[model samples]
Target: MPAARESLLDAARTSLARRPWSTVRMVDVAALAGVSRQTLYNEFGGKDGLARSLVRRETDRYLAGAERALAEGGLPAAADWTVTRARENALLRAVLTGCWTEGLPAPAPTAAPSTSPVPAQRRADGPLPTPAEVIALVRDRAVAVLAPATSTAGARATLARDCEVALRLALSCLLAPAGDGGTAGLVREAVAPIPYGAGR
Candidate 1:
């Protein structure tokens, strides 16, 4: 059942690349997924439900990338990875700002969803978080994940502050890509001062 739902979402995402979400149809997605229209409805309820699921799936992918980068050892590494991913994934940029624009072409139909385990279930009816809210969530999670690496109370406090700054720097570069030093250079410079903890 999970695989079937994933296939449907993949088809929907592929259709979205060629046209706006308003024009995407359930029949086409079902056909692409080799499932019946009823099955599609059963899986996602309707088009809006499907879209929300897609957004959540994409957001999860972005967060998974951030988690991996954080695991790579420090705040600077996390900043670099986050900036690079935002630049590469158009869906990430769109979800971050709640503003969709033409950016990178959508992934091919065969592309698979991220293999990272899904996080805790979210309420289906809640509205998606705004860009600022998303950043704050990231900041909080980063501090929680990285806090144990710090040896002193002062260093932990500083680490939390630096995580917030690093995320903001990455979001800034994503929103208005730097023309002079480039996004990577700018993000790295901003996060370079944060002390990295021993990998937990």
Candidate 2:
């Protein structure tokens, strides 16, 4: 059997995966993990702490995957950049979709979901890649993928930015919510200009 902390963490992950993070409570987590509330508190320092740990754990996994993708050439190499952005979207999506405002309040030990009535300071709806960051990630990786493609300094910069946009669009498509059309539409619009197999 997993240790208490591990059990609690796994329970939190499972619960969050099913319901919004705001819906999950420490009592619920303890019940699901088959541990005592005190055990959860002792290990996680309460709900917000647990949520932070969950985010950190997921972030670590994403970074590990990104590093590995960088090592392996091909689309997977570019996948490093895509995966980081995808993970951020997933986290943000969760916060946005799972909020409790006019309800009886979220279960104890957890902070009200970040997307509650107060609203998230960092809103979910925005440019997928923020343009600049994606441009940099792609440009740095481009030398490896686009070394053979002839281009002057200005041309290479333009190509890199376009490729980053293309990547962001692809990820947005892949990670779109099952029913939501916004991400899908954004992806379609963004990808129309970039040609594939042009970089690799």
Candidate 3:
């Protein structure tokens, strides 16, 4: 089922890239995934559910990548990852910035209860994160991984502020383009303990 689910999602993503989400046919998606329409329905509950799941999957991957970057190279690397990902993915960029352009499927938050038996679908049916929430989520993740156990309350608070600033800087880089190296250098400067403080 997991493999089938991923196949359906992959097909959907390819279809989305080719045309508008509005014109994407469920039957086509099912055929592309090599599953029946009823299987798609059982997996996703419907198109709205599929949309939510798609967004949720991207959001999860985005956060996972940020966490990995943070673990590997701290806040600046995470910022670099953020800028890179947002630049490459229109849906993710829109999700991060709260800007949904034409032809994109922007999944709205649902007030109705989810009755999907699928665990992933049920989670997807839950409230999706807004742009602000995405920022805070990434910032908090940075703090969680980067914060030292011995750091004081004030130190952790300062770290949180710095993480938020670095993340926002990444977002800014999306709105305003950077050089060939993209956000790495700019993010490194912003997250530096003492930016531009001394000669090399």
Candidate 4:
């Protein structure tokens, strides 16, 4: 069942690369996955469910990257990792902002509006897990990953606050990218206050 679900998600992802999520159809996904439409429905309940699952999967991937970065054990290392991941994954920026419209070119004026409604779960304001919520989630995960790297009681107490700063700085860099030294400089500035131990 997990493999079948993954296959459907893979098909959906491929379709999404070619077209907007608003236009992706479950039937096409099923066909691409070599499964019956009923099977797709059974697995995901509907398009909205499928979309949520996809978002969750992508979020997990992003967090995994973040965990690996924090495991490297220094503010500078984490900053570099965050910036690199943002550059490599366009989806990460979109997820961080709760808006997926970035990087996509505006549709031609003559193009017809999609007949399909935007998923009801997604609103004009934005998607689930607002930017603040996402930042908090990332900060919490980062603190956990970085906790072992900190030695002093003072460092542990301040780790969460420091992570919040780091994540916010990274998001800012992603939204308004700086040239060459700009992002690295900003990251260093953000992490300057965070305490770290040797060999971490």
Candidate 5:
């Protein structure tokens, strides 16, 4: 079932590349996934369920990539990842920027499929985070990954602020690409803490 579910979502994403979600037929998605339409309904309950699941999967993947980027090189790397992914993934771009644009499915709250046998589908049907919520989630995730357990609350707060600065810069870079052709330098400069007592 998991495999079928994943395949369906993959097929849905591929179809989305060619057409709007509103026009995508369940039969086509099932055929593309090589499953019966019945199986599709059994898994997702309906098109709205599928759409919700698709958006959830996309956001989850994007955030996971952000976490990996953070682990590899902190905020600059994460910022770069965010910019790159937004450029390549339209759904993610919509999720981050609050612009659904034509052909992309916007995330929204949907009633959970109480009768769904698939737990994943039920979760997917739950209320989705808004673009603002996504921003907050990423900032918080950056803090959790960047700030260590030993760091004091004050230090963590400062780190969180830096994370927001980096995230905002990255988001802005997406809206307005840097003429310099990258996001890392901008994020690095924006988040770099001032040296203590430098003004003296």
Candidate 6:
């Protein structure tokens, strides 16, 4: 009776909570959701399709909150990143990491490393983007989103950078310990100029 997307999301969330992203099976999600495997395939096409939907759903929620807060000058932008950082914190990371919660013991602790091992740390060989460079990108995208004067190319570049920064921030939030708040302050700082200047 639920909408197809909501039903799919509910099933996907349950499966993700039980196991790592790689191990989650579409069949399991369909079973949990009470939908036939054919229906699941018809709706989502595949696991990758479902993952993208999940990402978009989560991102849409965050963006809605950001839009609401952005009304108070550029403060909303800062608030948006802060909220996003909190959502991506250790708790979410633990879920993402495929470690067991209180329930779902059959999977077992020794089922295999839930996440991939990182390659040896290495220095960057190319020109590195400074935080300011990253911020400029955020600003450009915000302008394109909020202001009609900014050109599409300018906005596209900025949007791309914002995405890059968001990924880095997500990683930091997931890896860092509690109370650190990850790179929230940095994201806030980066996002501030957009809303503040747009109203000028």
Q: CA lDDT, every prediction?
A: 0.67, 0.50, 0.82, 0.64, 0.82, 0.47
Tens-digit lDDT track of model 3 for 20-120: 99998899999999999999999998887888888888899999998898888777788888988888888899889989887878887799878888988
What is the Cα root-mean-square deviation between model 6 and the actual structure? 11.4
TM-score per model over all chains = 0.77, 0.47, 0.92, 0.74, 0.91, 0.47
Residue-wise lDDT of candidate 2 within 1-200, one digit each (tens)? 23776687788878876777767788999999998998777665567666655554543454444444544533334443454455555552232223333221232333233332211111211112323543354545654455345556775555566555545554554455323434433433444443433313
Candidate 4 stretches with Cα past 4 Å from truth are 87-90, 102-128, 149-153, 197-200
lDDT tens per residue, model 4, 1-200: 76787898788878877887777788999999999998887776677667766665666677777777677655455656677776775555676765567333222212332222333213211344656887777677766666665356676667767777767777677767756766556666656654553113
Tens digits of lDDT, candidate 6, 1-200? 23755787777877766676678888888888888888776665566556645643543444444444433433334333544544553223333333334432112122332221211101111122333443443444454445455556655555445545543554455446325343545555554344323322
The candidate, 2 or 4, that scores higher on TM-score is: 4
RMSD of each: 7.2, 9.7, 3.2, 7.4, 3.8, 11.4
Worst 10 residues of 6 by lDDT: 116-125
Worst 10 residues of 3 by lDDT: 191-200
Best candidate per TM-score, number?
3
Q: What is the lDDT for 21 in model 4?
A: 73
Cα lDDT over the full model 1: 0.67
Candidate 4 lDDT score at position 69: 68
Candidate 2 TM-score versus the reference: 0.47
Error of 1 at 125 (Å): 3.1
Per-candidate count of clashing residue pairs (backbone under 3 Å): 0, 0, 0, 0, 0, 0
Model 5 clash tally, residue pairs = 0
Off by over 4 Å in 1: 101-122, 149-153, 179-182, 198-200
Off by over 4 Å in 5: 111-115, 194-200
Cα miss at 80, model 1 (Å)?
A: 3.0
Which 10-residue window in model 1 sums to the lowest lDDT?
A: 114-123
